[model samples]
Target: MTAYVGKRLAQAVLVLWAAYTLSFVLLSALPGDSVHNRIANPEAQISPEEAKVMLAYYGLDRPLAEQYLHALGGVFRGEFGYSLSSGDSVGHLITSALPSTLQLTGLGLVFGVLFAGVVAVLINYGRWRWLRSLVTAVPSLFASVPTFVVGIVALQYLSFRLRLIPSVDDGTVRALIAPAATLGLVVAAPLAQVLATSMRATRRQPFVHVLQAKGAGEGYIFRQDVLRNSSLPVLTLLGLAVGELIAGSVVTESVYARAGIGQLTVSAVNTQDLPVVQGVVLLSTAAYVVVNLVVDLVYPLVDPRILVEGRSRRSARWRTDGQAVESAADLPAGSARRLPAEVAMP
Candidate 1:
């Protein structure tokens, strides 16, 4: 366990570093940098001496190698440099804007999980064939609808037509609902799709038939056996969805006129604020890495069998006579464990 955790942490660090380095290189390769763009602006009307000093201050006068090293060092020191347009510390701007984004992300993730769980359960277990078919199609429809479109419709109807909740310039929780729901729906679509598929496959396992013959109701069987067994794939999909969630938050924030990392990202890109842009990139990368790291750690808890993959055959043996092994209690009772558990007893 210690080795696994340490390995995941190391990989996370490597990913973060790679993301930062790539972003810096790409931003540097842009036609003109923030410093030149700012100094060249006719409105600034700066003299040659001031321009020279500005270049020096931003380290544009230094070699690319030196600049990269300096920026990398500053990152190590917890300094994200400065925003070219506002001349404010990039770290400070990110710190200030982080709260709103965090609030939205957290709310979005919670709503997403709830919505996805309901949809997945309904998809696999609905009594009526028509209802099951309809529920199955819902994920596809959700996948087709973009976050911006959802946000627009919600904003117009909820805020303008109905006036049910404040959408603009309202700092309260009421204002958060529209955008967070938009992001949540986006997050829920893929999750529901993956979870439903997993559940469907898991339903075909032989143990489910035995449970049915034993008079286990559908709901009881699903809750007691299928849900837990199938959730490993859902956990994996959830980790991958972090990227989609963040991306959707950007558009959602824009449509709802919410202040957050998304808005900050739009402004930075429009003005070519390289430092702020890089900071956002790094922040998003860190979020993705951290979520996946947590997912990796959770694998063992979900199914200890996960820890068995990609290593030498374990130093363990399965019980020939099953007396309710906690993990495989639902699999079979009074059955000898075969090499792959595929043996059929006559």
Candidate 2:
């Protein structure tokens, strides 16, 4: 387990580095420097020498390789550098915006998992065929809909038409409902699909049959056996869903006009703020890596067989050797008894 954790941590560092490198390359390839983006108005133009000085100030005049090395070093030192557009520390901007994104992500993940689990249970365990089919199809329907579309629909119906929630940003929990639900439903769709499929497969396993033969109720069997067995794959899918959640947040935040990493991302992209963009990408990659690391750590606990099966195999090998030795010793005197293959081999 310790070795596994260390390996995962090492891999996570590599992932973060890769994300930084890729973002740096892509952002650097874009036409025009931060100076042009910052100085948007042609009417308020500066001299060519002044533009050169500005580019030099931001170290943009350096070779790409040098800039990349500097950026890599800065990341390791927890210095994300200054935002080209705002002249504020990229780290500071990210920190300021992180809380809202975290809140939305947490809430959306919780709600999505709950919603998916409920829908999966109803669809799989319920008796009505029509209802089951309908519920099963709902996830596919939701999955087909984009997050932006869902957000807009929710805003129109829930906020504007029904007036159930605030029409615009109020920075209140009530204001979070539409955006959270939009993100949650998008996350929930694939989760529900995978979970329902896993549950169906688990139900067909021999243990489930044994439980039924023991006169266990369906609910008890499902709760104790089916759900637990089915959860491993679902947990894996949930870990993978973190990326989807982050991607969806961009659209949801834009629609809701919420202040978050998503909104910060949009602003950075529009202004070609390379440092801020790199910072956000690095942060997002870290979040994904951490979440998957947690899932890896939790996996053995959920399925003890993962840990025990290796030990059992080693013990079985030892027992086989002992049995071969015993069989060799018990050979009849002068009876020409052939030794077992295992004992004769060595």
Candidate 3:
């Protein structure tokens, strides 16, 4: 288990490094420097020489390799540099915006899991076959709809027409409803689909039949066996859904006018603020890696078979080594084990 965790951590670091390098390269390739972007205002007119000086001041005139090394070092020290557009510390900007994004992610994940769980239960455990089929199909339909479209529809209907919630920028819990639901519905679709399929397969397994033969009730068997077995896949999907949540947040926050890392990212891109953009990308990559690492660590807890599988592999290796040793011992002291005669060394 320790070795597995160490391996995963190493892989996570490599992934983060790759993401950072790619983001830096792409941002550097973008036309116009921060100075050019800032000097675009006619009232704040600046000459080409002045722009050159500004670039040099910001160390943008350095070689690409030097700049990359400096940026990487800054990241390790939690120094994200200054935002070219706002003149704010990139680290400060990210920290300020991170809480909102975290809240949105948490709410969306909770809502999605609850929605998927309810739908899966109705589809698998309910009596009406037609209704169950309809419930099963809903997730696919929801999955097809883009999160932005959902956010727009929710704003139009739930907030404006129905008056069920406040406007998107109202800065209240009620304002979170539309955007959270938009993201939740998008993520819930795939989760529910996977879970429903897993549940159906679990129900058909021989153990379920054995439970039935033992006179166990349907509810008992479902609660004790089916749900537990089906949960491993669901847990995996939940980890993967973090990416979806992050992607969806960019659109959802834009539509809802929320202050978050998503909004920060968009603004940084529009202004070509390389440092802030790189910071956001790095932060997102870290979040993804950390979430997946947690999922890997928790996997053995969910299914002991994972640990057992590792043990089985080790046991097999040990058995092979023992057999080789015994064969060596059985051979005469001065003789070597026979090798295939196909092409023995000349």
Candidate 4:
């Protein structure tokens, strides 16, 4: 078990290193220097010497390879670079924006799970076949609508037109609803579909049929067999849905003008803020990788078969403290055989 975890942890480190390297390469390829763009305002008339000093201050004056090595080393040492655009540490910027995005995704996932689970369970009840089909169709509509469009529509109708909530602020939680709901809808749709299909499949399995024939109550079968068997697929879909939630909310955040990581990413890209862009991209990618790793680790807990498989490949050893006894009566003086005399006697 320890060896398996060590291997997975090593693999996770390699994956994160590769992702960070990839982010650096992609950001490096973007046109223009980070400091150049920031100080290029015609009205400001920034001099060449000042620009050079700013570039040097952010390490942009160094070769790309050197800068990358430094950045990678800094990451390992718990240091993030200074932002060329904001003159603030990249770490600080990410820390400031991290909470809102976490709150949004976390709450959105909760709502999505509850919505999906309840709808799926109720819909799959055989008595409501027509209603089940109709409810199942709700996910299709959600899948069809783009997240950005949902954000716009939500803000327009729910916030602006209906006056249900206020329209713009970075400080309060009220500003989170429109964007979170927009993203939640997309996540809920597929989760519901997957859960409903899994539940139906579980209901048809032989164990469930056997339980039904043996006079077991529907609730008993559902609790003991159906839901248990259905959880693997549902959990797998949840991981994928979480990825979709993050990706979808990028646009939703922009549309709602929220100061989350997504909005920060967009601003970083538009202005070609390399440090800020790399910082945000690395932070978001780290989040994605961590979420996936957590999901991977959780799968075995949900299914003991996985734990068995993980252990079966390894060699097991046992130690004994005393000489072997040939017969129950002939056993060593201090050791008593637990087996019956008829069985242990030779």
What's the residue-level lDDT of 290 in candidate 4?
73
Model 1 stretches with alpha carbons more than 4 Å out: 314-346
How big is the positional error of residue 210 in model 2, measured in Å on the Cα after superposition? 1.2
Q: Candidate 4: list runs displaced more than 4 Å.
A: 38-43, 170-174, 313-346
- Which residue window of length 10 is worst by lDDT in model 1? 337-346
TM-score rank order: 3, 1, 2, 4
For residues 225-271, could you state the per-residue lDDT of candidate 3 as single tens digits?
89999999998998899999998899989998899999999998887
Q: Which candidate would rank higher by lDDT, 1 or 4?
A: 1
Give the per-residue lDDT digits (tens) of candidate 4, residues 68-99: 99999999887888877777888998899888
Mind sharing the TM-score for model 3? 0.89
Q: What are the models' TM-scores?
A: 0.89, 0.87, 0.89, 0.84
lDDT score of residue 339 within candidate 4: 38
How many clashes in each structure?
0, 0, 0, 0
- For each candidate, the alpha-carbon lDDT, in order, equals 0.86, 0.84, 0.85, 0.76
